[model samples]
Target: MSELKNSPWITCFLRPQELLLLLMLRWAIAYMEDPAFPHLGDSSQPLPRACPWRCSCPRDDTVDCAGLGLSVFPDNITKAARHLSLQNNQLQELPYNELSRLSGLRTLDLHSNLISSEGLPDEAFESLTQLEHFYVAHNKLSVAPQFLPPSLRVADLAANEVVEIFPLTFGEKPELRSVYLHDNRLNNTGLPPNTFLGSEAITTLSLSSNQLSYLPPSLPSSLERLHLQNNLISKVPRGALSLQTRLRELYLQHNQLTDSGLDATTFSKLSSLEYLDLSHNQLTTVPEGLPENLTILHLGRNCIRQVEAVRLHRARGLRYLLLQHNELGTSALPAGTLRPLRALHTLHLYGNRLERVPPALPRHLKALVMPHNRVAVLGERDLVSARALAELNLAYNRLASERVHPGAFRRLRALRSLDLAGNQLSRLPEGLPPSLRSLKLQRNQLRALEPELLAGLKKLRELSLAHNRLRVGDIEPGTWHELQALQVLDLSHNELSFVPPDLPEALEELHLQANRISHVGPEAFLSTPHLRALFLRANRLHMTSIAAEAFLGLVHLRVVDTAENPEQVLVQLPPKNKGALSPKG
Candidate 1:
């Protein structure tokens, strides 16, 4: 057998079965050396693909060379690479001759580069016939690139110095769907009426943060989302949107639009419109003749004084309404102003002049955010219709504890989070919903925390009473017993002389910073064995006042901050693997 394995003519002296096995071994060796057969016995286990230097190939078809700071494009790019990302570089030009070599290229991203219009020849992208997505945003192009590939679907040219767009800049691109040209120098005269006429399939066009002073007279009829915010647009002619029946979302915030500047019938013909934003304008009333299918409307930061239900009568499907930072008063919002909007889910009336909660709110509302208003009281039946209410934010209001009706939040069974911070409440409000999980009462005049205030709050996990007048005796005994699920308790910026007792066992973080705490007893954290973080900065603590066994029961404590104390106290902490004490500064 040894002689047969070494001899070149072994097959001549082998038996019939042995001769057949030798022939099969010779055939396998030849197959292994063949270049066409690159797999290791199975096609699924192919060799690794080629990758270029200073670039990463996450997939065989994708190449990411972003944030390499390369002044020139890298060489040796794979021919089969379909997606090439060269963003956040200093490349000044794109060599079309070399780029044209990638015939199968589908996406090319050069965003945040120094490429200018002079570097892009008229036929710079004509050779990339298979290209679909082209991103050149944050460049120095003074003019948009003409002769774009006909197969392009998304074109991003935002954050450029572009001042002009030729009539054929986006022409003959039937597959185009989105065009982003925001943050440019394009004005009303710079955009020709026929610039996008040939791109019939365009659905989203963003022209925000521009120098335009008026609405474009002509736009693509197939646009579904049109963003024209942060412009100088002051007027919308009668037929400005007459042909945009298929439009769904329109953003016109931070413009100079006024009631007199907008024609009454400008947006009446958009039958498919669902979202419209006219915030930060000079309108004194809601726009009339809104689309019937409109669901969300943003009319905040305007000069509007009243909201006539007749103007919103057409928008029966409206769900989200924003009228914050306006001149709305008690008489501005009538009782039935929002009754017609049965589908309204969220309403924002913050920073208004209203003295009380509006009546006849939507029944199915989920959130009512009216912070920074002049509301002095909450009526008992104000929220009776909104049984599905979950979040209520009345922060920075004049809500005193006595003025808040006992049953104001009784009907809101689904209330989960309530923010009443920055109020004049000396005591906790009564009749809080038992389903609440998070309650914020910071920056108020709260002096006491009675046990009855938290009787049914078993699901409450977070309670914040910072920046209040709370004292050690103000918190009644067994006050925290009802909050079995409490994980975070904030008593910072209070008059507590020591750590409060009876912290919940599930408490994980305790914040007592900026307090008058002078000592910590050995049993301070006995009930909170699972505490992970403790903050006692900016207090009157001394090194001798903190007992050696103060944190004995806290095995999971990870962070203990006692900086800015009277004597720079540093407590002995657990091992490094468990936790460490933050150094005093």
Candidate 2:
């Protein structure tokens, strides 16, 4: 065997399956070289049980023969298999030690059977000293007994009828690292006062979805990750993680963390921490003094109001900062508030009470989100258009005028999409970057759209002018004579009284929702032979026939979003211009 393994010619001449078997045999020989686990031979057998399952096992260290309607454990199994799974059987009481003859057993999974918590004997698992993993989850255990292994590293007692953990139940397993005690009847107050008497050996812990409003004063310093999310955790011990210097990731999201619970020193000692998620909480005020090493901070869907991240200047590595849905007004961000975070790329300040625009924003920011705010003006010279800015979203603001400075976007040559929908604007602004591709101005107060406002956008492809007071007379030949690259045009939610003529030649998506359009005027969409994704949702149309030639006019019409139209609007199937429409249709 040794000569064959070292022979280079054997590797080149053997098939894949033959080579794999030889490699596995050689690997096992090298791994089991320990004097305690000797190899067996055909002539003179040694450690004969280890040869029974050298292969053909379902998973690593686990062998499942459960629900086979057997009366006793499979006696023909090998000793090398660490875990033996036999669940949902007809055993009333575990005949302890009958299966413990194999001293190499590491895990014993016996769940969903007729074994009750009261039926467990005192010395059930006391003999299995080498056992490090056990799974009794989803069983009929009501009261946990002191039956555990001293060398245990992980134990799953979850999804059981257990009421609480006794103080002495896990006291023997001082080396236990992970424990799953969730989804049980263990109340915070009903815990055995000394449940964590020797819990210092643990590194990763989870007590989520429980009745815990607070935690114990002391925790294991070796813990690197702790999850206390989705529970009644309203408060934690002062500087709860102060001693956990090695902690890298902590999940406390979806908890009731208020100002009192989160303070400046909450993460003062967590210098090694990297990822922290405190989103979906009732934090009314901004939590200050965050760990400087934090990379991704998710504070979205919380009650955080002001941009009062006092010491956030230290978070230089922050890439994504989400502060959506709060009482944050634009005034809260002082001049140069975000200028230091040059590395920041994505900023979500949506759904706030911002009154005016901000200045001196991060120059290298890629995404700028200020949607659903009370913004009336995107202040001039306030914050120079960052050339690196790609997406600008100011949707659902209170902007009424064309106050956006022209130079504000000249430097933003990377701007691809601009959303100014749900605002009070009557007309689009100028100085739109030449690189602009998409502009969303839906649900605005515009009565007319001047052609020159959009003629400068040479690369403009998608434009949404829905929910406006636009009239049919607002259309003309110069509407888009210069924009040869125009494609998707949304004119929905407007009081358009008439249908225009000869829309953009490349027009694809046309929206005319919530309008008073009565005339499907002549030459309408005649230039658009590649129109698609047309929407006529909610409108009053006086032109009922919508001539059969009307839809046959366009060649590439597809995906018409006219599902929710008002009673007055008429519907019709559009035409297709072979190869004239987009290939995506």
Candidate 3:
């Protein structure tokens, strides 16, 4: 045939079977235009339908599939998914047509799955009519999930086991705005009244850790942050938030609220309330129609003994007044009762029973946490009008360094932290405020340290004489040279048998743990070169009494604790190219 098609052994065996059938018909037209190649009836496939191969189409409309232990629901998802993250999967059920062809789904993050409201199907999300932000938070939902999707706007059922919230379950969701039912087990007859009647675009309403004693008078006057904290809410019935007059933040803290279940005209109709957490409630008194544009008033652990200046005369823009652990003493605040709080700046009367130090306060008071009171004297007018006092926690009071009166913190010249830890101080309390930078005299009865007891404290940086009775000749020689901004030096449970030489070269943390330190002088931390934490735990050294240049020039020594010392005391430090000490246990 045409001379056997110009015969060269039939052109090398039939043109190698026609070049292997034209490379198998061009790889079957690129495997039918690979839209992840499975659909064989290719009607002009250009490649767009893929997405669910253990999900992550980063953009042709997002399908994240978080924590893929996905129990089900990832059946080739790409119907042009508009943000669909099945978060922390093991997703039990959502099958009412399982995302019914994702009608252009908009943000559906099934958070921490195991979805249960009897396995979600009251028309499970009714074919998501362009759903808007629906995170099913930590699921196993007991109720609150009805037809939903009137194009819902942010409905996170937080830590769910949602013990009922049915009335229209967000009543005709008028584009609902932020409703997180927090840690659910919701009580008070499981929320009924108009359960958010016609939610006029709600603005953040988290019903916190529930077992709610009461709070459903149809909230949502466009609520502006109302987290009902850890509830068992012992009554708030007066018009229960009177239509939330644009509430500005009201977290009723660890509730069991008393004072006969509060009704100070229900927070005086929250005139745009500004942050009010009635802390651990059982209130003895202090809840009177508050909200004169209140600015932060957390009444700590209540039983508030007395603070009546007409209950803070209409809170004139009060600035942070947390009355800590109540039962306030020493005639419980009577003189001018905090002088009408002129924009008071932070005054937490710590674990109250105050014997003194709370007169007139707030002259722009900057942090005055009155620690475990019964104040036994600290004269100089006890912080004379707090000259903008910068943190002064009178720790476990009953002060005793001769009852501390000499210049008692000289008008607190903006004192920077001075907590006389568990007091009864045996010394060192004179003048003090050289703008003191943290000096907590731990478990006192200080046995001595005298360089005029830390002369003028050159901006001392954290020096807690741990469980004091410090001894080794009671530290007198250059007693840590004007503490050159000493960085953390707590001589733990002191009776120091040694190690105290010059010390402060900007010493960074040296807590001699339960000390009886049996000698370690190789210049004992020689001028502490930025020494990084060296806590000699329960000492009595013996490894030839430690002197491998005893941690020489500490080159930023990183944590060294010679554990409970004498096991023949192997102190061994000098390694990190001759320094960076690491033996911390």
- Which candidate's TM-score is highest? 1
C-alpha lDDT of all candidate models, in order:
0.89, 0.70, 0.82
Best candidate according to lDDT = 1
lDDT of 3 by residue, 1-585 (tens): 334333446335557778576556556766766577757466664655587886778788887989989898888787788888988989888767757678789898989989899787767566778888989899898987766766778888899888888766677788888989899898868788778777788899898998988766778788899899898888888887886788889898988888878866888987998999989988998988887888999999989899898888999788889999999999889777887887888889998888889777767878888888899987877678768888888899888888788887877788888888998988778777678888898998888877876788899898888998888787889987888998998889888888788888897888988888877877777788788778887788766777888776666676677776765455555556355444555
| lDDT by residue for model 1 (1-585), tens | 444345687667889998889977777777776677777677766777778788999988999999999888788888998999999999998887768787788999999999999887767576788999999999999999877888999999999999999876787789999999999999988898888877889999999999999888788899999999999999987687998889999999999999988765988999999999999999999998888899999999999999999998999899999999999988988899998999999999999998887888888989999999898988898778788989999999999999999999888899999999999999999999899999999999999999998899999999999999999899899999989999999999999989999989899999999999998988899999998889999999887878888788677887888998888787877554254655435
TM-score of 1: 0.85
Return whichever of 1 and 3 wins on lDDT. Answer: 1
Supply the TM-score for candidate 2: 0.72
- Candidate order by TM-score, highest to lowest? 1, 2, 3
